[model samples]
Target chain A: MRYSKYFLIIIILLSVFNLYAEKPFKYVETGVNTNSWALIPAGEFHFGQHQHIKNIDYDFEIMITDVTNEQYANYLNEALEKGTIYAKKDTIWGYHPGDPFDAYLHEWEIPAGDYPHMPINEPGLRLNYENGKFSPKAGYENHPMVEVSWFGAKAYADYYGYRLPTELEWEKAARGTGTNDYPWGNTVKRNQANFISSHNLFAKMFGDVVKTTPVGFYNGNNYDGYQTVEGISPYGLYDMAGNVYQWTGDDHPKVHYRYMRGGSYQSYEYNLRVWPRNSAGPEYTSMSLGFRCARDID
Target chain B: MVEWGVKDITVKLLGLDLESVERSGRIIMLYHVIAMIVTSIEVYMITSIVPMRKHQRTNINATITVGWITAMIFGMAFAYFGHNYFYHGLFLVGQSLIFFAGILLAVTLNPWNKHFLVENKEYAHTKNGYDLERIAFFVMTVSMLISAGFGAVTGSFWSNGHETFLAEDLIRQPDKTALQKSIIGYLHIMLTLIAIAITLIVGRWMDFKGKLHKFAMPIMIFGTLVISGGVWSVVWTHMAHTFIYIGSTFVMFAALLLVIYAWGKLIKDRIKEQGLKNPSFGQKFVALFHDPIKFGPFWQMVFMNFTVSGVGIFMAVKLEEIFRVWPAREERITLTGHWHIPAALIATIILMYYIDIAGIKGKLRKWLGWTIIIGSDIAFAAMTIMSMKRLFVTEYYQTPLVNWTMLATDFGLGIILILLAGVLGWRLIDLFRSDNRWSKESASPELELERTAVLTKQGRDVIKKEMEI
Candidate 1:
C-alpha cells in the first residue's frame, strides 16, 4: 500500500509538470475558421522615432493577414441578420452617381441570391456587388477586404472578441527588435509589396484589373513572378508593407483622425516605409483601406 | 541649378511630363527659328512703313536690324551648343537670347513714340502727358532689363532651386531652401515689382488720351492684380489665404466692371460715328479666297488666341488630374471656361465679319455689342458661383482634398478665369465696333488717303494704288 501511494504521488507530480510545460506561443485559429493568428510572446519592444524611442510590453495574438472580404461579408451578414448592424448607401468622394466614367464609387452590401459565396479554401473575396448585395468578382475571393471604415473595422474586431492593434504593437510585429526601414528590411521593391508598381504591372498583364491582390498571395517570395523572400515581416505577418492599409488603435480625438499603418496597393514606395506615419478621418473609407485584429493573451 | 522637384513642378504646371521635356526642348529650338523670321519681318515693316522725318531713320533702322540679326545668330548657336552639351543652363541661355531679341524688337517698335509723333502733334507743345509716358516706358524697360539680368545670372527663371529634375525629391525635402530667398532672387523680385509699377504708371498715361484709350486703365489694373495675387501666393505663402482669397478677387471684380464700362463707351462712340466704308460685301466675300497671310493681323490674333486657350485647357486638365481627390464640378466648370474663351474669341471674329457685310449699325450695333459682353459675363459669373460653392461650402477635409496650397491655386484660377472672360468680352465688342475692319478698303476717304501715304512710303505702290481705286 505504501509503494502504490508513492507511485500515485509521482504520477500527480508529472501531470502538474505537463500542465506547466504548455507552449507560450500557441497558434490559434478563428472560430469561423476564416483566419489564422500567431501568439506573440510577451516582450518589450522599442517603438516611435529615434529622438523619442519608447519601450512597450505586450503579449498578444494578432491576425496573420488583414481581414478578407469574404470574412467581412460573413460578419456583415450575420450582424445584419441579428439587427446589430446596418449598411447605408452614401456618395463617396470622387465618385459621381450615374457617371459611367466614375470608377471610384463603391457600394457596401451583403451577399445574397445569385452571388456565389466565397469558397472555404480561398483567402477572402473582394467587395464587388450589384443590387445592394455582396457579390465579389470571380477569382477575387482571396483578395483583402477594402473600402471599410475604421468604425466598421472596430465593429468586426469587437464581434470576433479582438481589437485593432495599437501602433506600437503593429510596428513591433512588422519590424521586430530591429530598426528596419521597411517590414522586409531596408530595401523596398515591386516584389516586396503590392504597391503602385505591382498594380501597374498587373494592369498591363490583365486588362481592367483590380488594384488589390489576394491576401497572402505573396508568400515572402515569388510576388508577381519575381522570386524574393524579403517581404515577410519578423512576426510572419503577410502584407506588412502593402496590400491594404491597416487601421491601428491609435487616435487623436482632438483632430478626429486615426492612425493607419503599413501601406496599400495605391501607396508609393516611400509611403511603404515602416516608420512613415499616415492618418485619416475615422469615418473615411477608401479602396486602399482595411484592417486586422488582435487579442490579449490570457 | 534647378532642383528636380522644381523642374518637375514647372513641367507639371506646363502640362508636360518628364519624358516630353526633350521633345519640348526641340520644339522650343524650332520656335527660336520661327521667332527670328517673324522678328525680321517686323523689323522690315516697322522701318519701312513708319515715315521717319530725319536722316537718323537710316541709322536707327540699321542698328535695330543688325541688333536683331546678331541676337538671333547667338540664340541659334547657343541652342545648338545646349543640345550637344545636354545642360539645362545652356538651353536657358539660348532661350534668354531669343527673349532678348523680342525685347529689342519691342524697344525698336516704340509704340508710344510713334503714336505721339504720328497721331497727336497738337499736344506736342504741352507735352506733359507725352513726357510722363516716356518716363514710364523708360522705367519699365530698365526694370524689365534688371529683372531679366538677375533672373538669368541666378538661373532663377530656369530652375526654382538646386538643380534636380524630379518633383518627388523636392516634395520629400520640403525644408530645402529655394533660390528665391537669395540676393539675386530678391533682386529679380524687386525689379519685377518695379516693372509692374511702371506699367501701371504707363497705363495711367495712356488713359489720359481721352475716351479712345478707355480700356487701358482697367486692363492694366486687372493684369496687375492677377500677377500680384500670384506673386503673393508663391512668395508670401503665409499671407496667401487672406490677401489672395479676398483682396485680389475684389480688385479683379472692380477691374471687370471698369472693363465692361470702357468697352461699352467705345462701342457706343463707334456706332455714333457710323460704320466702316471699305470691305464691301463682295470684297469681304472675295477676301476669304485670298491667301490667309494677306489678312495678317486677323489670322495672327486667331492663331495666338487659339494657342493660348489650348494651353490653358491642357493646364486645367493636368491640374484636375493632380487634384483628383477634389470634387470634379469646380474643375469641370473651370475647364469649360477655358474651352469657351477660345470659341468665343473665334465666334466674335466671324460675327464681326458678318456685321460688317450686313452693315449692322446704330442701335443694333450697340445692342449687339452689349449682348455679347453681358451674356459672356453672366455665363462666367454662373460658373464662378458654382466653383465658389464647391470650394467653400463643401466639407473638403473628409477626403484627401484638404491641401491648402491646392485650394489656393484653384481659387486663383477661378478669379483669373473671370478676369479673362471680361477681357475677351471687351475685345469681342471692340472687334465688332472698330473702324479698322479686316478689309481696309471700307475705311473713310481721309483714313484711306493716310493709309495710301504710308503704303507709298513703304514702297508698296501696288497696294497704295489698290487703296486709291
Candidate 2:
C-alpha cells in the first residue's frame, strides 16, 4: 500500500510539471477571454514573388480567427478604464513607436456623436459606446472587428501582451509550408471563400447579405464537436484567405503604407491568393479591414 | 469668382460635407458646367453657320463630324463620372444632360441638303478657304496639345491617387516615387505631341491627290485602333493618368480624321460613283435608316440617346430618396413617363417605316405623320409638366433652390425638344408627299429628273459631259 501511494504521488507531480511547462505554447492565454490561437512551427516559408521573393523563417502562435468585435471592445474598454490608452473622438491619431514597418502616423477616430447604440448582443451594432460602456454590434459579437486603424489594432495587441503578425509570419501561416496559391490549394473555388463574382450579377446588384459571413461560416470540419478542419490553413489557422484584410507588420517599400494580407469579402478571387500583396495607408479604415494578433513562442 | 462661390454653395446645399464641397466636389461641378456651356456654344455655331450653297454640303458634313466628336466627349465624361462619382446625384444629372444634349444636337444639325456639294463647287480648293481652314485646324490642334500637356503635368491622369473629400477616410498620398510620376508625365506629353504631329501631317496631306491620301486613310484608322487599345490597357492596369492622356490622344486623332473627311471630302469623293450622284434628301434619310450599322455618326448618336435616357431614369429611381424631387405619386408618374416616351417614339418610327414601305400615299401618309407629331408632343408636354411640378409644386424638395437649378434647366430643355420634334415631323411629311415608294427602279429616274430641274444650265452641262464620258 505504501508503494502504490508513492507511485500515485509521483504521477500527480509529473502532471503538474507538464501543465506548467506547456503553458506558454498553449493556444489560449490564461485569464484572457480571447479565441484560441494556432501554432506556426518554426520553419522557412517562400515569401512574396516577382521582385519581392525571398525565404523567410518564423516561429509564432497566431489567432485561429481574426480578432472578434466583442474581444476588441472588451480590450478597448479595459484599456480606457485603466488609463493605459486614450481615445480622441472624431480623430484618428496614434502610432507604434518601435514598429519596423514605418507605417505613417495618421488620425482615424470614429466620428464623434455618431456611435450607434444597441444591446451588446445585436448583430449590426458595429462599434458603439454608450453610458460608459463599449460594445460590439449586438448579434455580431462573433464577427471580425473592422474599421480599426492600424494603430488601433497595434494598441489592442500591445495591451494584450501580443503583437501584430509580421508579413512573413502572416504569409507562412496562410500558405503553410507548401507553395499553394490559396489555403485550399492552387485552384480557387467559389465555395472556398467569399468574393465578388462576375457570374452572379443579380446578387452583386442587390448587394448580398453574405458579404461578410460569420467567422468559420465555411470550410470548417468539426471533429469531436470542435472545429478542427475545413477551410483551415496548413498551420490550422481559420480564415487565412478571406473574411477581412488582416494588417501585417510590414510596410510597402515605396510608401508610408502598411502591408495587408489575405483578402476581404469584397476582394476578387485572384486577390485572395497567398502570393498577392496589397497595402493601404496605416490610417485607412473600412468595414472590410481587421487584424489578427500573434505572439512569439518563447 | 462670385460664380465660383455660388457653385460652392450649390454643392454645400446638395448635402455634401463642407470639406468635400471645398475640395474635389466644387472643381468637378465647375468642369461639368463648363463642358455643358462649351458644347452648347459649339452646337449653336455649327447650326448657325450656313456656308454658301456650294459649300453647304461640306458644312453639313462638318456639322455631322463635329456632332460625333462632341458625342464622344460626352461619352467619355459620362464614363469618367460614372466610374468615379456615381453616388453623387447632381453630377450624375449633369453628365446625363451633357450626353442627352449631344444626341439632340446631332439629330437636329444632321446634314440634309442634297445639292450642297454641287452648289459649293466654286469654294473648293480656293487658296483663301484653304488658308482659313488651315489656320483653324492649327489653332484647334495647338489648343488640344496644350490642354493635354497641362492635364498630364497636373497629375490629372493620376486619378487613382487623387484626394477627395468623401474619400478622406482613406488618404492616398501622392505616388511614392518621383521616377514613376515623371515617367507617366513624360509618356503623356510624348503621346500628345505625336497626336499633334499626326494631325498636322494628315491635314496637310488631305489637300494633295497622290500617295499620301492613299496612305492617310489606313494610317489614321490603324493609329486610332492602336491608341484605343492603349486606353483600354491603362484603364485595365489602373494607370489612371495614362488612361486620360491616351484617351485624349485618341480623341485628337479622331477629330483630325473627321476634319479631313468633312471639309476635304477625301473619303466621300473617292467613293463617289455615277449611280450615287444627286441622291434626294429622302433617299439619303432612308439609306441612313436602312443601314444604321454602317453610319458611324448616326449609330453613335443612337447609342448616346439610349444611354442617356436609360441612365437618367435609373438615377432618378435609384436616388429618389436622396434627391427628394417629387412625392411618391409624381415620382412614379415621372418614371413611367420617362420610359414610355422613348418607347412610344421608337414604335412610331417603326410604324411609319412600314407604312412607307407598303407604299401608303396621299392623306393617309400625312395623317400618320400628324398623328406621330401630336402623340410625341403630348408625351413631351406631360414629361415637362411633371418635371415642373416636381420642381415647383412638390412638397418634398429636400435641396435648396440653388441646388434645384439643374432640374429647372432640364425643364427648359423640354421646349427645345418639342420644337425639334415638330421639325422632324414636318420633314417626314415632306418625305411622304414627295415619293410614296422607295423602289430603286422608281427612285433613279425621279432623282435624275429632280437633278435636271434643280441644276443651273452650267451644272446640267457638266452632268451631261460626265455622262458622255
Candidate 3:
C-alpha cells in the first residue's frame, strides 16, 4: 500500500511537470510557388543605417520578394497529382479550399499541378499591357503580373503548396540596402520609377496619352545604371516601388485585410513611399496589383 | 522539543500579559504532549486490560477515564492557541498515539502466536492483559518529541514576545527568518517519516498476522491522511480558509472512525478475556448461505449492465462525432440514434438471465452462496472501472447527464470498495478462527462420534462389575 501511494504521487508530480514544460510551435515552409526557390540561408544584411530599432540591431538575410503566383500554382498541381491533399492542407490550412471558378463561371476546377490558368479580361486581371493581348502596347510577359487578391494569392499559394510571406519579410525587402523610404534614400523623384505623375495609364490617339510604360522603359532617369532600369528595389529588385502595388500575404487584424506594396501608375508620391501600407481584402483584385515570391530556409 | 506537561498556564503568574505568542506556543506544545500520552495510555489499556485477573479492571477503567479527561483538556487548550496551530497539534498528537497503538495491536494479536491455528495450546492459555508497554512508551516518547519539535519550529516565526490570542494573526506573517523556515522544513520531513513508518509496520503486520479486517483499512487511511496533512501543513497552513478548515474537520472525523475501529478489534479478539473457541466449517460456511440467501450475482449483473450500456452508448456516439464519422444532426435525430438500441437490448437480456437463474430455489440451494461472494467482488472491480470511465466522459462533455453520472459512479465505487473490504475481512477472520487440527477425531465429528460409541460398548462389562456393590 505504501509503495503504491508513493508511486502514484511520483506519477502525478511527473505529469504536472510535463504540463509546465515549454511547447515547440510548429510551422511549415513552402513559399507561394510550385518550383522550389533557392534556400536563402539566414545571415546578416545591410538594412537602413541608424533608422532601425537601436540598441538591439542585426542585419538579417530575408526572402527578397513576396511568394509568387507561378511557384504556388506548380505546388498545387504536384500535390493533387500525388494524392497528397491531406498533407498539402494539414501543413497549411486545417481544411481544404474549394476549387477556383473559371472565366465563364460555368464550372469550378481544381487546378492541375503547376498549370494555373490566369483568368482573362476580368476587371482585376493583370494585363500584359505591352502586348495588349493582341496589340503591341506597353508592359509584356517579362513584367511582373498584377491584379491578384490577398485571399486568392494565399489560396493559390497553398494550392501549389507554399506559404505567404510574413509582415516582417515584406518589411525587410521594402527597407532595401538603405534606411531611406522609397528604396531611394528618402527621395521621391519622377526620374526614379513609373508613377501617375511620370507614366501614362492609357496611350490613346490623344495628346499626352495616359498608359502603362513598357517594363524597364524608364531609361532616361536611371538612378542606378545597372543591367536594367526596372530591376532596382534600392535593395536591387526590378520595379519594387512603382510597378503595380504588389499583394503581400501579411494580415493585420485591425485592418481586417493584408497589404499591397509598390505604388500603381495612378498613385501619388505618398503611395509610392516604400513604407506606405495599404489594406486589401483577400478577394480584392485590380489591374495594378501583383506579387513577388520569397523562399524560407533553416 | 520535549514537552512533559502543562506549565506557566496562569497568564498573570508569568509576570507578563496573556498576549504573548511565545507563551502561547509553549502552552500549546505542552498540552499536545500531555494529551498524546493520555490517549496512548487509553489505547494501551484497551489491549492490555483484556484477559486480566479479576482485580485489574478497576485500574484499567481509571486509566481510561483519566485518558478521556486529558483529551478534553487538550481540546480546550486548542481554543487558546490559534485554531490552525491547535488542530495541527491535536492531529499530530492523536495520529501518533493511534499509530503506536495500531502497531502494538498488530504485534500482540498476530495469529502466528498459535502457529496460525485457532486451537493451538497457547491460544487457550494466553487469555488477555497482553502488555506492549515497552513499545508503546518508545513510540509515545518519540512521537511527542517529534511533534513538539515540529510545532516549535513551525510556530517560531509567529512567536514574537507576546501571547497572541488571534489564530489568524499568528499565521499571517510571511517574512520568516531562514532559521525558522528550515525548522518548518524539517518538521514536514519528520511527520512524513513517522506516517510512513506507521504504515509499513501495520502493513507488514496485516500480511503476517491476517488482521486485514481489524487493521489494514485504518492503517491505509492513517498513513494517507497524515502524509497529506504534513504536506499541507508545510505548504498551506495560513492559506487554508473556512472551506478548507471544514473539509479538514471531515477528514479528521474519518480518522476518528479508524481509531474506533481499532478499539472494536481489541474487544472482538477477546484479548482481555478467554479467547473465543473455534467454530466448525459447516457452522460457519452454512451461515453464509442460510437465510435471505444473498444472490448478489443478480444485483451485480444489474449494475454491470447499467454501467456498460450507459458508457458504451455515450462513447460510441461521442467518439463517432470526434472522428467525423457520425451522421449529420438531422440524420442522427431520425436514423442513426437507433444504433445504440442493440447494445441496450443485449444488456437487458444479460440482466434477465441473471435474475431468472438466481430466482430458482434449486439453483439458489446449489450455487447461490458462492455466486453472491464472487459476483459482488467482480461487480466491485467493474464498478471502479465504470467510475473512471464516467470521469473521462465528463472531462470531455460538460453536459448535465455526464456530470451527474460521474458523481454517482464515483460515490458508488467508493461504497463498493468499502463494503467488499468488509466482507473479505469477515471471511478472513472466519478462516483464522476455524479449527485447523489434523487429528482424525478433531477433523471429522461424524467419525469421532462413531469411535466414542464403540468404546462405550467395549467398556460396558467392566462398567457393570464396578457398579455391582
Best-fitting candidate, scored by DockQ: 1
Against the reference, the lDDT scores of all candidates come to: 0.47, 0.48, 0.39
Better of 1 and 3 by TM-score: 1
Docking class of 1: incorrect
Q: TM-score of the candidate numbered 1?
A: 0.42
Candidate 3 lDDT, B69-157, residue by residue in tens: 54445544554444555654554455444444445444433322321222222112123322122222233334434544555555454
Per-residue alpha-carbon lDDT of candidate 1 for residues B1-469, written as tens digits (9 for 90 to 100): 0122234456456543222223233444444344444434333333333332223344444554565555455545444334433344444444455455446534643534423332343211123323322332333344445544544554444434334222121221223353443322333234233323322322231223343233333443444444444443444364533443353344334333333333343444444454545535554444342322112214323342334334444545565332233322223444444434434333343343333334556665545444443444344334434433434433312122223433544554444355447645665675776564433432321111121012123335544666799
Model 1 / residue A212 / CA error / Å: 2.4
Clashing residue pairs in all predictions, respectively, total 20, 22, 42
Across A184-269, the per-residue lDDT of candidate 2 in tens digits comes to 67655555555543224313322233235456644444322333225668876767777788888654443445667788765666
Candidate 2 chain B: minimum summed lDDT over ten consecutive residues — where?
A: B445-454
How does model 2 fare in lDDT?
A: 0.48
